[model samples]
Target: MGLERVIPVAEKLGVTRPEAKVLTVAGTNGKGSTTTTLAAILAAQGYQVGLYQSPHIYRFNERVKINGIEVDDQVLVEAFVRVDQARRDCQLSLSFFEATSLAAFLIFQQQQCDVWVLEVGLGGRLDVVNVIDPDVAVITNIGIDHVEWIGDTIEKIAFEKAGIIRPNIPVIFAGQQALPKAIQDKAQACQATLYAVNRDYFYQDADDGQHWNFASSGSTLRLPLGHLALDNIAAAIAAIQVSGLDVSEQALVTGIRNARLAGRFDVRQIAGKTVIFDAGHNPHGVEFLLKNLQKFMKNHDQYTEILSIFSMLGDKDINSVVKLLKGCILKWKIAELNVPRAASLAELNSALHTENNVEQFENIKAAFESALAEVKDNQIILVCGSFHTLEAIWECLEEWQ
Candidate 1:
C-alpha cells in the first residue's frame, strides 16, 4: 500500500529518475485514456514517447508502449530479467505490479525516450508510479473505488490521488465536482500551482458535435473528437498545455484524432451484432457510460432494445451499477466472472432482483453468446461491468476471427 517496498528496488535498478520528461496521471476512471492521449500528443510532436498503463485488456505487452506501438516480447523479457536481477541484489521482494512497473521504467530508460507518461495503477500517494517525480501531474477524477486500499470517501481518495503533486510543478485537477480540500491543501503545501477544470481551463462540445473546443486563459483551439470521452481528452490537452512542451496545434489535432482506447466505449461489429465493450465498473464510471450510450441511441435511433452482457468484481457497488443501466438496458445476461474477486451468481442475482428480464448463464462467454444469439437488427449488445468481462468476450471472439 506504500512505496517503501518499491523505492529501494527502483533506486537499485537505476530507474528512480530516468533521463526523460515525465507526466504522471492519477485517478479512478480516466487514467488509461488520459495517459494514452497524452502519450499520443507527445508522439505526434515527433518526440520518442513511452507510455505505461495498467490492467491490460488482451495482452501483457499492452501495458508498455513506444510511440503508440506495443513493445516487442523480447524487449519486455530482457527488461524483466534485468529487473529480477536488480531486485535480487537489493534483497527485496517485489509484487507482480511492482516488478512489471520497474521493468517498464527500465525499458523506457534504455530506449532513451524523450517523454514518459505514467498511469497510476491504484491510488497515487503510495503507488510505484510516484517513485519518479513528474514534470507535470494530472488527476483525471476521483471516485469511491478501491476503497479497501485507498479509502471510502471522496476526500480520502482525493488525498491519495494528490500524492503525485510535487513542488513548483503544474498540477491539474479535472474532477467535475468541486476540488476536494485535501487536494487543495496538498497542492498549496507543495507550492504547486493547481489548474482545475472549469475554473482554470474549460472544454465544451462544439455545435457540430464532430469537433470540440478547449480554452484556457491564453489559448483556444477547436479539435476533432476521438474515440474516447471528451472530458478525458480535455484533461490530456490541459496537461500538455501546462507541460510547457514544444507541441504545435496540428499535433494536438492529429493526436486527438489518433488516440484510441480499448474497452472505453469500444464499438465493434461482432457475430452479426453491434457490441459496445466498456470497462465501467463503479457508479461514477457507469454514469459516464450511460451518457455515451444515451448519445449513441439518440444518433442511431434504430436501436430500440439494448441487451447487456454484464459481470463485476465482488467488491464493487453492484446494486448502484445495475440501477444505472437497468432503465436503458432492456435485458441483462449475467454470469460469474472467472476471477479471484468475481461476484458470485447469488450476488449478481440479489443486486438484479428488481429486474424482470434477467437471464443467467454459465459464464461470461455463454452470456455473451446468448446476447448475440438473441440480438436483432434494432438492438445493441453491450459487454461491460469489468475489464475481465471484456477480456472473456475478446478471448471467445478470437476463435471466430
Candidate 2:
C-alpha cells in the first residue's frame, strides 16, 4: 500500500477511469500553464477542483492538488494503499508517472470534486492518465519533443498529444499548424467538437502585440494579459467557454494577470541581476524561449548579452540544442546534472565547442559560479534546458545558504 505499489492494483481495479467533469490538457509545452489557469479560474468561480501535474520540482505530492493545495502525503499513501490492495499481484510495469496517475485517478473518484485538471505525461492517447474520458479536452501548442515514445515528426507527435481528445467532448486547440489539423481529424473521427484559433476562436496580444486574444464567436479583445507570458491562453479560454464555466471577461483578465506556472521563463533575482529559469529542453521550446526573449528585449536595441546556463538528459539532442541556442546566447555555462539521465560535461562541450562563448564545468554549481563571475550586472542569466538543472540549482542554493 505504499506509494510504490501501483501495478496489479491498477489492473485489479480495472482501469477505473473516473466519470468526473474532467479537463484533460496535452501538448508539447504549456500543459502546466493551461491546466493551472483552468483550475484557477474554476476555483475562483467556487468549484472544488482536483489538479494533477507532473515531474515534481521538489516533492511527489506536487502531482496532486485540491484547490491549489497539494494533496497531503497521508492522502497519497492511502490512495496508493487502495491501488495496492486492488492489484494484489497482477504486476503492471508502471513507470512512476503511470503509478502516480492511477493513484490520482482513484483519489479524484473518491472526492466530490467539481472538476479535474489532468496533465498528460507523454502521448495523450495511451498515457496512463488517458484512461479517463474527459469532458473538456485541450491541446496547447504542438511541437517535436519526446520523440522516442511519441514519434519523430511534428505530425506524428501531434497524433500522440491529440489522443487527449475524447468523443462528444468539445476540444480547444492552439499552435496554428498541421498538428491542429491532426487533432481536428481525430476529433472528427471521434465526433468531438473542435474549436481552434483562426477558425472558431483566436487570441491576439494587446499592448501592441503583447496581449492575448480569443476570437471566438467572431469577436476579439485586447488581451490584457501582460507579464511577457502567453502560454496556451487562447486555447484555455476557448476550453473554459466551451465547458460552460461562466466567468466574466473580468475573470479571464484577472486569471491571466495572476496565473503563474513555475519554471517556464519565470523571472527572479538571485543576487540582484535579472535571471530567467525555464525547463524548456527540446528545440521547439527553445525556439519559443528564444523568440519571447527576443521579443521582450526588442526595446533594448543595445546588444544585451545572454548568459545561458544549461544541463539536460542524455536522451535529448544536445547538438540540436546547441545549434538552436548558439547565436542568441552571449555565453554558455555547460554544467552536468546529478540525475542518472543527465548529459555529461564532455557531451555538452562537444555540442557547444563550435558555438561561441561556451565553457564547461564539473557540475551545475560551478557553472553558475563561473557565469556569475564573468557576466556584467546588467546582463541576464537564463537557466534552462532541463528540469534537473533547475532542481540542482535549487539544491545548491539551499546548501550554500
Best by TM-score: 1
Per-residue alpha-carbon lDDT of candidate 1 for residues 1-401, written as tens digits (9 for 90 to 100) = 88888888899888987879999999988998999999998999999999999999899999999999999999999999998888888888899999999999999999999999999999999999999999999999989999999999999999999999999999999999889999999999999999999999999999997998899988999899888888899999999988889999999998998999999999898866799999999998999899999899999999988999999999999999998888988898999999999999999999999999899999998888777778889999999999999999887786555
Pairs clashing in candidate 1? none
Candidate 2, residue 208: lDDT: 63
| lDDT digits (tens) for residues 6-71 of candidate 2 | 434564675455555789998887788788888776776777889999878767787898878888
